[model samples]
Target: MAVYTYTVDNANLAVQDLSTGESLTDIFTYTITDSDGDTATTTLTITIDGVNDGAQQGAMKSKSWSQA
Candidate 1:
C-alpha cells in the first residue's frame, strides 16, 4: 500500500479589486507526492465573476436649474 499527499501551491486564492462586469482567471499549481518520494504536478485554473454592489452606489439626487 502507498500513501499519497496532495498540496496546492497557493492556499489563498482569493480575488481582489474585482469590479462589476469584470472577470478574472487565475492558475495555480498543485502537486501530489507519494510515500516513495514520487511526485506529480498539474495546473488548476479558477475563474472568478464580479458582482454588483448596490450599497456602493450612491443615491441619485435631483437638481433644478433656473434661468437668470
Candidate 2:
C-alpha cells in the first residue's frame, strides 16, 4: 500500500501565529511583495488510507491413540 504523508518545517510559523493581527497582515503583504518569502509557510496534510487484506487461517493439531 502506498500512503502519502507531508512533512512540514517552518521555523517562523509559531512566531507568526503569536504575532498580532496587524503583524500578520503586514507579513502577508510583505510576503506578496517579496516573491522569495516563505509562501508555503506552515501546516502540511497527510493522507491516510485503509486497505483490505484477506482473512488469515490458523494452524491445526491432531492426535492418535492406541489401546490393547
Compare the candidates by lDDT and give the number of the best one. Answer: 1
Computed on alpha carbons, the lDDT of every model, listed in order, comes to 0.65, 0.36
Candidate 1 per-residue C-alpha lDDT over 1-56 given as tens digits, one digit per residue, 9 for 90 to 100: 53544443333444434568787777878788888999999987777776664554
Give each model a TM-score: 0.46, 0.24
Residues 1-68, model 2: lDDT tens digits: 32544443334554323422322221111212234664534333343332333344663467899998
Sliding window of 10 residues with minimal summed lDDT for model 2: 24-33
lDDT of 1: 0.65
- Model 1 regions lying over 4 Å from their true place: 1-21, 57-68
Clashing residue pairs in candidate 2 (N, C-alpha, C atoms within 3 angstroms): none
